[model samples]
Target: MRPLSRRELGPLTGAAVLALAGCGASEAVPPQSTASAGEGGTTYPLVLRNGDREVRFERAPQRVVSLDQGSTEILLSLGLADRIVGTASWTDPVLDSLAAANEGVPRLADNAPTYEVLLGADPDLVTASFGRHFAEQGGVVTRDRLAETGIASYLSPTDLDDGQSVNGGKKARTTPLTVDSLFQEVRELAQVFDVAQRGEDLVADLQRRAREATEGVDVGGRTVAFWFANLDTPFVAGGKGAASLLATSTGLRNVFADQAEDWPSVSWESVVAADPDVLVLGDLRRDRFPGDRLAAKEEFLRTDPVASVLSAARAQRYVALHGAELNPSIRYVDGLAKLGAWWREHGQDL
Candidate 1:
């Protein structure tokens, strides 16, 4: 699975590793919880809100049905592929090693699995991400409806809550979606499978590598910008999210670190005005690549004038990533390392 690219981490760009809320057997899921489940000796009860419905996991789901790419990645990472009986949408290219296994697991549905297909799968647990992926989005099966059918469900923390505030006190958003959070999710799932030790080992290895990659120089004064796909329509990374976190951890400065929300759209002029020292490029549609990004950057410089004067482009140093990694999951960490490596090679002091 591709990790969230450095370009994806827009605003919440920082060095400190973001932590996932650890759930164990001791953490009893609240009444009408958002997520709940158990496997081996552990239990994962959901504690998240999904619009009007609350999501939850009830027990260790042996017959799992994953509805989102992020959930699929998480399940597969924990060596629980055997538990997954089905999956859906934008997941065709992933888990190549499990090709034969997937052949039998039935594509749950097209972009969004139908309620009938989901019920037919006979899944003990159903996990989804986007609202449309669930019945709540029209005829789609709502989590509550799934529960009524004796199925448990969990929504990725990122998709469950948008870190918005209501009724005064701010509601917590998905537990920090970064490499560290990815590790925690892996660990939590491992516990569900009675493989906590293995989860810890995996996390340790990843963190060790990340630390080595980011060893140290200085970054307080450095400035960078993460550009996703369209250079003409600047979709800048924001603070308090994966892309920004990766940049800061790698010891580079995110130019859009001041942005309020994560992964918000911006303008071409903004890029020119920001004039970041380094700009990270994410996957662009194949047709748009080479021409689109190049033309966009050139045009920006031509019009803004100040843009051409930036050191980042003058040095011809930019990091490009596949679209897959932009999604929040274990792959996000890999993206971080790749970007850090690019920075190190391109004269980033760190």
Candidate 2:
């Protein structure tokens, strides 16, 4: 997406400044210089590295707004539903699935809100799943600008750009998307919201589920191609991401597991050469961008110029998964279970 022009930023920036000035210390709580224990014995004035910046939570956020579904779900899982004031996304199906938990939460925007609109919520903290949520392409309120105003932010470890420098010029950690990395986000956020026990408990449960999912699952030497998104060319889940982690649990191997990128685009010729035994089509709805629908993607594989004759396509060995589920978040364990179950039943045939 194209970034907004400087001319577009001037007025919105002014409105945001006004909104910040209007907040009487309630909406704009500055990070404290000292740390102390708070609710449920969670340490306060907590400082942690989230994505590319240092975030300090002086106290539990009063008016929290989730900038994406991943953060929204994480907040809810930690029993912070009452703390959330606003949410924005491109029709997050995960939030939709947890509709009862998210009932009455303010729907801020279908995508990232403008600076004026974001500030109107009087939010103390804005949590996001991806760096793009704070991207200039989205609108005003970049993390640095928000920090100057004492409003804090967070970015999921999985969402930071791999090449970007974070926290004292260290390159961002953006690979081998494992369950521990996902749970670390939960534990870290749990600390942020003063819900350490709940976070630990969730992490333990996910750990147990993942263990059980992988236990006794035989791969039968069937390599898989986790097709993330594409129309003509396939944008695949490379070896170092969530898809590969899930594949490990199911005893299957990822054909694209030799790359450094978390998710890498590959030619169908590569797919042909790899000759994966199974396919995992990530089903994405066309909410914001024109997403590649599951049905359409399957059809393309069966009828396209190159993909039509691929072994995985002809065999019809596809494990359909929600695009959102594959994102490194609370649902990662669910992904393990889903793939484990599907492959156990279907993958045994080949």
Candidate 3:
């Protein structure tokens, strides 16, 4: 991607900021600055506490490899598209507003890139939303391995505190996640890039949009279930992920909030037992799983003997959300806005 002009790098305002809507906190606290501010207000040899690891940056990274779509979008939103050399693990198309900036970046893989490919990109820093991306085994590469090559790495704070197990086990969140988690990530990334002011502006814009979307919208007694991709065993949202944030923000109760895992695979019988008031389905573009597509999920709900009995399915009370939006990312606010609007317009009738 070409270097963003001064105008483009300036604080996003009005519609330009709104257009990006089309696309959480944990064990690791907000990045703690260990040194005084240097030139440009960011001190060199900056140390950021990432989970249990500490990432030090001697200078602003010129080339960054974003290992997940969430991280990639964050970088693009910060006007650091030019700094991104490679991206991977995309679940959906780039946000409409970010497509142009992302066009020039190389995609290392549709999923996780191999260690060799990641290193070949020659990136100074790599960022990922999932800890599995940096796992020692069954992962692309580990943080220690990257450090051996002098390549710095950053993991989302939400994935810290052993909430995310690297052995492909179910992810569990000890504390509930919220949009503030995402804001923290943006702020930390901006600090890393020496663009603290831009981070503040973006955070303020996101906060405003979130407030506007949820203001005075109360669907207190309503309950909902978030269905991600799966057929035999559906992966529904648990208490501590993005779904929890959406539910809490809009005053909707999550049927599966009792489960602590982020996404738990439960039988259709269990879903019927919960019998939520609304079904928030993930409209994913990737077809890696049997029910990855929106239509497939909808079809299963309408045809399956067990699933077809659901009240939400019978009433057609479904809220379709982008798969990316359901994850911990900037688009989560979009999900909140959509859910609140749907509840205001249609939820009362049900």
Candidate 4:
């Protein structure tokens, strides 16, 4: 099977859970920094961070190549779609406005593109979120190898070690993943594109809106729990991950906020014990989601005798939203805005 894109992994894939564990607490700054001063006039050096590897770009990358969805999405949000010469894999369909811009951006190879194809793209920079994408065992395009080919790369901080890994294995590490960290990444990428000023403006706007939305909206002391797809297995979003950010941003109290880290698999019995006020069901059904999916999900929640007793159920307050869209990115602001609107329209003064 092909290595799954983050969204394709879904709630059952356990990839999000693993990714969450890999994520470290937000850092005050990028791991490395540099300014490119030259005729290129871009003055942006690629800054790479995700543990052991670090890099800097000297100019705005003209012929850019992104190897992962998150990095590609970030580039699109920065309005650098024209600069992106190639992509490896894509999850969501490109919006119509940007589809023409992405034309001829080759897929490199099926899953992991080869070095010759990457070099063929003649890109100045190659970016990704996972270290494994850049380097795996067996002749994979290592960062050093790519640099040797005159291309620089980066990995997101979410994949860094930062003392979050346990003896090179998985363990219970509860570091917080903050929106601030994602903002910093955006800033770094903006700098790469020589658009830091624009990035700062966008962040300010998003922060202001998020702050405004959260103002004075009490949840009436009701707590919330996030449900991804499978209710029987009870895949839940934990306190310090993307889901927590959404809940906290929208002024809803996440009942699983106490469960530190990202996606956590819990039992139906656990939901009964917590008896949260509302259930945030992340809509993963791209093809199957309907207007009534929320209602159906709520009905499914009722099957859990433990969850059935919650105040949210009695009032039928279950909410369905696209799951993949909730991750930290430019679109996060859109999600927050929608959530705030929902809370105000249906949840206020409860």
Most accurate candidate by lDDT: 3
Worst 10 residues of 3 by lDDT: 14-23
CA lDDT of each prediction against the hidden true structure: 0.57, 0.69, 0.80, 0.60
Clash count for candidate 1 is 38
**Alpha-carbon shift of residue 119 in model 3 (angstroms):** 1.3
Clashes of each: 38, 0, 2, 7
Off by over 4 Å in 1: 1-39, 43-59, 89-120, 129-141, 158-180, 217-220, 230-232, 284-315, 348-350
Supply candidate 1's per-residue lDDT for 268: 59
Candidate 4 residue 230 C-alpha distance from true site, Å: 3.8
lDDT of 2 by residue, 1-350 (tens): 88743224432432222112221242333345345676657665556766545665556767788887777888887888888989886433754547787886887886777777787777777877766656655444677777666577777766554534221132224456556666777888888777899998878887887789777777866788888776656778877766777777677888888875666677888898888888888877654333367878877877777887888788898888776677667776767777878867876588
Residues 1-350 of candidate 1 have per-residue lDDT tens digits of 77643124321323111112223223343455434343344544423333344433344557778876667766765677788888875522564554555555566754566777766666766765444555343545655555444455555545433432211122223434456546655675566455666777767876777677667634555678876645446666776566777776767777887775556677756776788877776653333333234345445544555555666666666676544455555556566767766756766432
Residue 63 error, candidate 2, Å? 1.7
Model 3: per-residue lDDT, tens digit, 71-189? 99999998999999999998899999999999999999999999888877877788998888887767888776666556778887656545344213346667777677688899999
By lDDT, the candidates rank as 3, 2, 4, 1
Models 1 onward score TM values of 0.66, 0.81, 0.87, 0.68
In the order shown, the candidates' Cα RMSDs to the true structure are 11.1, 7.0, 9.3, 10.0
lDDT (0-100) at residue 82 of candidate 3?
Answer: 92
Off by over 4 Å in 4: 1-50, 87-124, 130-150, 158-173, 285-314, 348-350
